[model samples]
Target: MNTVEWSDALLLDYEPMDTVHREFVDLLAAAQNASDAALPQTWAAVVAHTVRHFGHEDEWMQRTGFASADNHIMQHRVVLNLLREGLAMAQAGQMDPVREMAGELAAWFAKHTQTLDAALALHMRREPPPVATVHRPRGGRGAHASPG
Candidate 1:
């Protein structure tokens, strides 16, 4: 079974964020199920996706003036750092850490999505559109980008 399963419960009703989150769950599952030889590449894919995923959310938070922007971004940074460390360990043939990290990420994602991400989604829905177009970087690795 996938470490994180997608369902209605995870929907934030924000298409852009929901799409990226679904991709994150899928990537996590891929990493979890990867063959030993494929684990590093799969994990690297997840890291790349997360970099863009978090970057996209951070941009949205900044644009929308999310009340907890700093705290949210900091959480992203910390998690990304740990994921990178797991990737490095996987590169060194230490797959156990990567597997464990994937499991932990599943739990973290559930709570973070329902709490932090849901709040951001609600905030975005209530914010007025920006006067100018927000310039988002091209989407990360396997995902497509949408305007924030």
Candidate 2:
């Protein structure tokens, strides 16, 4: 199982998204590193953070009309559901699966960040290039630069 840590590579270059993602990384790491007695509490925090994090992105995608909004949001739904299932497994004394999920989640997040989140961040930060306007002479006829 691979353990992912917060690094510059994970930064999306967008502060709002980065802030939420940073919290996610911190919370997930806490859960992954928690003691057996503390696992449930820590894991619950992870679930909570994920719900808010994904919801935040969903709103951004909808508001900004991201080209892949449907696909991106669907991925979030799938992962969120999986995380919720992990929570239930933890409640049922299935710490191993929850632990396993932490590693898998970390791995998933790394790739998702690079692809989806990176693109979203770029889109959010993109600015339209300046357009130059050509002014026509008062008359409809084109002005002759030089008389024949």
Candidate 3:
């Protein structure tokens, strides 16, 4: 089961960008399922993907001049750096760092999706939906999975 799942509600309707966001949720689930001994490796992958994901969003924000881009990017930097730090500690044999970090990440994910990301999604939809190939979650609020 996924600890956090991506959905249309979290998207800005920017296909290219939404694809990256969905990948982030998928990666988050993969990291959560990794075993203790394999977690650091999984976390590193997660961290790399997260950086890429944030970068993509930043790029979109820059191109579109989203007013909240600065604030959103700042939040991304803070949370991602924290995840990277936790990964470092876990790699150094701290053992439980990613587990605690998972919970934190999940909380952050939910809040961001419901509030900040939601705003961006709404903004992106103001014009005709973008032409990039993107998939958004279908149906209602619970149509997509969330943290367990």
Q: All models: lDDT? A: 0.91, 0.88, 0.78
Off by over 4 Å in 2: 127-148
For each of the candidates, the C-alpha root-mean-square deviation to the true structure, in angstroms, is 9.3, 11.9, 13.6
Candidate 2: TM-score? 0.83
Residue 118 C-alpha lDDT in model 2: 93
Tens-digit per-residue lDDT, 1-148, candidate 3: 2277666666666566577778877877777877888888888888999888888777777778899999999998998889889888879878576777876787688788778877777777674545786555676455567778
Put down candidate 2 lDDT per residue, 1-148, tens digits, no spaces.
Answer: 7786999999888888899888999999899898877888898899999898999889888877889989999999999999999888888888999999999999999999999999988988884433677776667666555465
List the candidate 3 regions with Cα displacement exceeding 4 Å: 6-13, 127-148
**lDDT per residue (tens digit) for residues 1-148 in model 1:** 2287888989999888999999999999899999878999999999999999999999989877789999999999999999999999989999987898899999999999999999999998888766976565565343555568
By TM-score, the better pick of 2 and 3 is 2
Pairs that clash in candidate 1: none
Each candidate structure's TM-score, on Cα atoms with residue i matched to residue i, is 0.85, 0.83, 0.74
Q: In TM-score terms, which candidate is top?
A: 1
TM-score of 3: 0.74
